[model samples]
Target: MTETMDRNFIWDFIEDDLANNPGMKVHTRFPPEPNGYLHIGHCKALCVDFGTARKFGGVCNLRMDDTNPAKEDTEYVDAIMEDIHWLGFNWDDRFFYGSDYFEKDYELAVGLIKKGLAYVCELSAEQFRDPQYCGDLTHPAVSPWRDRPIAESLDLFERMKNGEFPEGKYTLRAKIDLASGNFCMRDPVIYRIKYVEHHRQGTKWCIFPMYDFAHPIQDALENITHSLCSLEYEIHRPLYNWVRDNVDLPGNPVGFPRQIEFARLNITYTVLSKRFLRGLVEGGVVDGWDDPRMPTLCGLRRRGYTASSILDFIGRTGVAKSDSLVDIRQLEACLRDELNATAPRRIAVQKPIKVIVDNYPADKTEYFEVSNNPQDSEAGTRKVAFTRELWIDEDDFAEVPPPKFFRMKPEGEVRLMGAYIVKCNEVIKNTDGSVKEIHCTADLETGNGMPADGRKIKGTIHWLSAAHCEDVTLHLYNNLTTLENPSAKPDDKDYTDFINPESKIVVEHAKVEPPLKDAKVGEQFQFVRTGYFCKDTKYPNTFNRIVTLKDSFK
Candidate 1:
């Protein structure tokens, strides 16, 4: 790996490891089990794993450790690859599966058995039930087949390979200490007789290696140098190494793959656990894994988040020791910052209020050149139609002003942005007590005044020509869960219980400027004062408001 003068801490650690062992090559791999869709947490992990490899000028392998076939499927594998590719990481033709090492893992287990290091355990499903099956440091639970003869183990294991065992009839256990302080060191089941089909290997095998036994060996077999993972696997490291030491390498796969742990990302307001997310999908609380309100990478992409924003978010969150939940606002800020510099400015009206430009001639219409970006001058400009009628945000005007409100009020003068200065001559109301529309007269010259002059208004607001506006499907998103009370346990309650019903608000036939009708999918643009938005990838032609320049709600 090539190191620049400003090396990140991860590089420093890798450099030290390599400095100590010059013979070893630096390689890293992101081994996500393809059991469920990846979430924001996985996005962060991907950044660390792949970004570190890129900086060091090394290769990062995308290995799907699909060891547990029961919960895994081809759907997951496909989604995983799509997410990784979307995040802009190519695994360098080193894509792999732990099942690729099934034969080796089985052979190694048999070797361990032959060497008296493992045995076939006959802990009946009843005996392996409940707390009795759980392992702990002080008191390790014993299995019935702990004392089984090596020959019996070999025979059962061979039969297991030959598909002679029923699913729960026998489990191959590594004969480690029964009372080690580390619960994993206690005699753990290395392989289980699972008669299930695998996504990649198909119906070729019945017995599968357990994750703990399969993962490290696959890394060693691939000659992987650094196996960076979330902190949860820190405890699993001991067993990770124990399997490496016991199983003699095939072709002497390089020094046992080193395991490093960093805190995993925990995004607040939405559940990140695969189990909980599964419940959300299966229970119909969410439309699916890719629901724009969900935090899956696909969901983020569909919700109009840029890959660079995600990567920047991950890098900024960085590695931590004690894990804490991050506010979703922080993520939105990254997008807002990214979009502000990239997206063009356009006017859209959600809950639109109609305004009649009483002074403009009915047949008159004109174009005012508006800059695409307010922050950058070189971003240039686009023309917008200023007709006799215009639409502004419904909330922009009030019949009786709320004191400090600057937008629009009875007799208030606010510039209809880029068009003309206008005064609210009247607030038209319905008998039902809702403001139907506002009547205004434009200052022809205070547009600087053939109609009026130097008219100072309290506020300048966005407007789209009523005659020239295009219909758009707009989606406004909010946090899925709504407990502003931060101390509320996101884990204790069913995630669905906390779900904000207003999370995904869809607006049909929302009016927008004529320019955005041809706006392509994933093209970001500022909707005037309405915050940052992009064409949703799922809808492509539809717009999704991401976040605003200011945290107005906060």
Candidate 2:
């Protein structure tokens, strides 16, 4: 069942499914709980559901499993929709919510009670807390109230629905098995008494169905053929099918949705769980959910990631059953590959140092013709302002550079990106002993973007006019968690405790070209030698680093 997927294997599976029932319609669904923003892992399942359906000429549904009321929110639903659209998926009008079947679900629960197949149990939270509550392979402990009369059960269930019972007083349990080999088959709770108001359903349902019991029925109700999911739901498939078989569904008996499990996406040095991600945000380890340093979809967007690149990445990951961790570099490689062809290039400086063109006239300012994006011939060219005093990265020049250093050093000549070839004459020192400025002489005749004719320079450094520079905020992002694998850690030390506080560092003094002053919030731009950065939604004045220029940090 877990063999490697090849072209032959894929065709074989499709042929088998087609041969099994020639007329059966193929339908798939991407069901997500609206608790938090979707991560990169969710993208894997998304591609499988929608991609598979489209390939097979079937329909795919975008369903929200809004079962738990406490963590779910309208904001999450909106975010999820936005992400799906950003990923280029159109559900048309097939968007469905689990809470939409409230009335029908209640009738089904009542039907089970009437058949004596389900009983309302009065087990307290303390009972389940014990390790021995779920008995071993040979023995299974029966709840004392398991044999309560159906009349009393129905009466108590009605009272439970009437709001007479407290939150945990009564729960509807399926009488599937008390001594079955499967632990989940041991009379699992079908419905729990939750008194909280749902985000979508409001206070209409106090007795809500458990996810394990409701998911399969809901899938069947919507005529979902393939319930695509992560590997984690592998064990829950049996329980998923059992609920559909026992309960009477709407219309035909075509509600037996086949559960298909694929490998969950795992990225190196990235913590993908919502709870751990929430901890990093709530604990102030990172800025917020959309912080470019974080791995949430919002964060990735804020970090200047393109939706097409993400889709391309998921496609490259392929469909497989083996669980494995993806190197973060591979993800970045996809990003760089896409951005290199799409994003226009611009020169910006981070730690600007003043370079005085002593030879050039002090008042003169001009624009140097530069390639907008070298990779894109259609991108054409743009103009950059070159002034008497220009700003260059502090690291570009070394007062006492190494013997073979090719950049700006004393008596060394380097092209000023779009401007002139300049030679450092003198280094000015500040009161604090830091290099305040470097005086240089630019050959006005050779100040063109590239070297004149066959003339050459050892290196070309990027620079912006100091007199025309605009202050831009910069956010340098790092991994959210310090631990490589937080999920594999011991239970004692909270994973949140290991969160790196320095995940995101804000740079308020970074300088940029005047052309970028109008860059809107969440916009992306290539920072020349720096990296791809997006306009921070939280701080519209700044840009956040998504990934470096290269995919590999090494």
Candidate 3:
């Protein structure tokens, strides 16, 4: 039975249903409004919707809930599809749009009116919200038009659809309750006059159904077994059922689609609200929706986050009824765990300090063997050039050493990783009072073999040979906002006010091994002790730091 598969309440309910009915496959749908780019928040819903069906050998429909056409666009529709596909879910041929069922939705509305369950009201938008007429549905003032003849409502509704009346002239509302405590049941507006063209159905109709009205009908028409949605829509469930039970919908998940709710995903230092994300893009606080620093899925992808890593992150954040904020490190940790095993190893020095092996032959350059990935021996090995002149990180050397600073200093010994151990003998200073270069001599006996005394080196640092190094740009990123919950800040303060000023920093003078110069876009590599990096999508010879070596995300 499906109940034995998982302990989540949603699957439990489905299991019980399948057990009693026998031979009914679970069906689900992910209905997204095509208004803006999808952010990480949507990933949670996608997992539930598609994953549940996949678990039961069932099907999930990808529906565009594009009823409100005023802000919808084809660009957003395309992006949504691209992001979902990138997330490793395929809806196949079971795709739909709410506008595709608009005519059927209208017919259902007319059926409700003819049955005296709905009516057209002349009250302005503000009047519906008045204390006397709304809210206290237990003792509410009924609209004057509520008691009008059904014929009058049907006529007005037909006219509304025909554009005979101007926008805001009237609205068709459900005559559900005048005394119900739930506000959603208190004669909610079903359809409103909108004199705008829809992205898919242009100028074909003047009135459009509100989201509350269209959503359930769309689900019913598609015969979704479980109408899964975020917890924010829990209160809207009653209305979801009202439309399901009131209007006749074909097929069965034992009567009508059961609306199930789960918590949405929220991460610290990231805002997932499309409206707020749009502000960041429009205000230029970030580049665009796909900016590597943004939290949008495209942005994460652009930052080299893998679909498998995202799925693993979501798995770590199991499904629950109550909402909670996850630390961003959990996501980064998943990437680290993955890249640590799969990424090829390479040597890169971002802040280079020149080092001359004074005792070694000046024109000498030899190839030293290095493992591509120590975690996976099948990854093979690559050769790195060992030379008399090399580039090591500027921070690796200190003119005046601190306690236990074992990397490099005057007369300090450190192993140049994959090559010979070297001792810094002299420090050359520039006229500006800065260390210009460090002169070192290689221990001839330590080259590619053990010393006779078997002495151990305490510190090993990566180095790039000057003759074989390629200059590459590195893009490092930080949290976009200073506050963990920027969206929850005081009403008077804009989210942009919390934007981290140093969100993205570029190191244009970084040096890596020559082989890295031919790294194709989207290829990932581990820069020895530095961090995991991926070739940038838009920049040649540039890499985006995916995640640092250490996990500091608390």
Candidate 4:
């Protein structure tokens, strides 16, 4: 972590904590439950957790909160680690797992039971949440087993852990103030029984501690100085504090892990909930978890979003206490800003229109020197082949030109980007009245310099030599959800109703400059006048558009 003057409220609080406490270390942890692939929302938390720690020269642990075996898997665990690393954060030697401390957490549960601070309850899932019994924790609504004998409660807890009792038969709840306004403090369940196999722990323990109970203990055991989480857990702060105060932490430090909540990332046009995204995958609405249309970190990467761009987006979004929806354009703008300076330039014709130069020798092919990236001088230049036969964008040519149309038209002159000026002389039509070919004559002296007459050409269009171009596929992406707030629909309306039918458009026979034939997967380039694109990792000869050349959001 590099020391810097830039500070957010989180860092300000940490600075005060460090100033007050002499010789204490600044430490934070990114504890993500390995239940599903990480989404864009997690990226914000990741940056804050790791970025803060990095700024202050503190250690950040990457802990897996895999307390619930029912939904967790090693696959998600692997994906979570990959996503974190992909975002340019490393956990180093501080990687830990919540399930790894099951024995210690079990001991703490026993300590709570012996102290009469926790007990085994028999309330079913529904009955426990019944407003008649637990109305916001504002009044005393005791469970039937609240006053059970310590010995009996402990016995039941042991039996529950020993697999003698099936799941839901018994649960350990904290014996806190039942009249507290905060429901989280109202004797929250600390542990529950589950007979499922754990991803890491295997069948070692059938009884697992609940998230609220396990998270703090795991933090304390690992000496985590701060626990960063989203705003939804703000109310649970009281409970988090209660666990740290009640349990005899391993380190017994003068101070314990402090919990801070920040607004989670929300973007327009799509839902970020794991369940909704999983539904999209399962319902065949999306290709898979890594579908370019999805907001998963892996999906964004596959769609050509660089880690720096994502980090910049997070930085621009800033850390806020209040929740808000960020316009997706901000993210796209960050990506464009990054790619504009980094991606090399290339020429790709999405809709190929054949052009034949009558004055140029058909058998002669010449090369024109073109800069690979005008923004980057060190990127140098490459030679693009020019010949009598060329391919340009269909939209760039119109037989009956529209008003002010500067591209190729009957008898209209335009400059071939980095090549000679050409004048369209004839337009060949097919039986369907669509253009079949355009015959043009190029001024031999106009190339690599001004024309002899110093004529100004308003239109300069990219082109690829017909004999030297490579056939490629272009994938143009649009918003995945038609509705701006797809997840906010009425309960009766399905989220799938907002799925954008034209989200993914494929151009199968696009033509690109010959140099693109060697483009490796993940290599990015700006398709001059089209968009920024990356060679597809999943599909051969395909380039996924990162963003259009200009901002549409404005």
Best by lDDT: 4
lDDT of each: 0.80, 0.80, 0.87, 0.88
Better of 2 and 4 by TM-score: 4
lDDT of 1 by residue, 394-454 (tens): 8888777787888877787887787788888987778998877788887777552333333
- Screening candidate 3 with a backbone cut-off below 3 angstroms (N, C-alpha, C), the clashing residue pairs are 137-179, 137-180, 138-179
Candidate 3's TM-score: 0.95
Clashing pairs in 1: 1-56, 2-56, 444-450, 444-451, 445-448, 445-449, 445-450, 446-449, 449-452
Better candidate number, 1 or 4, judged by TM-score: 4
* Tens digits of lDDT, candidate 2, 89-121: 789999999898877877888888888888889
Which regions in candidate 1 have their CA more than 4 angstroms from the true location? 1-9, 129-137, 250-255, 448-455, 483-492, 552-554
Q: Estimate each model's TM-score.
A: 0.93, 0.92, 0.95, 0.95
Specify the poorest-scoring 10-residue window by lDDT in model 3: 1-10
Model 4 over residues 1-554: C-alpha lDDT tens digits? 22211457888888888888878777899888898899898988888888888887888999898898888998998999999888878999999888889999999999999999999999888888787777653467668888899999999999998899877888999999888878788889999888899988889899999899999888888888888889999999989999998987756465578998889888899688888898998889888888899999999999999988888888878888898888999899999988999999999999999999999998999999999899999999999999999999999998778899998988899999999999999998899988889999999998877899878989889899999989999999989988786547779887788888999999988999877878899899999999999998899999999888889764
> Residue 32, candidate 3: how far off, in angstroms?
1.4
Q: What is the lDDT of residue 231 in candidate 1?
A: 85
Query: What lDDT is reached at residue 298 by model 4?
Result: 94
- Model 2: lDDT equals 0.80
Q: Candidate 2 at 266: error in angstroms?
A: 1.2
Output the lDDT of residue 283, model 2: 80
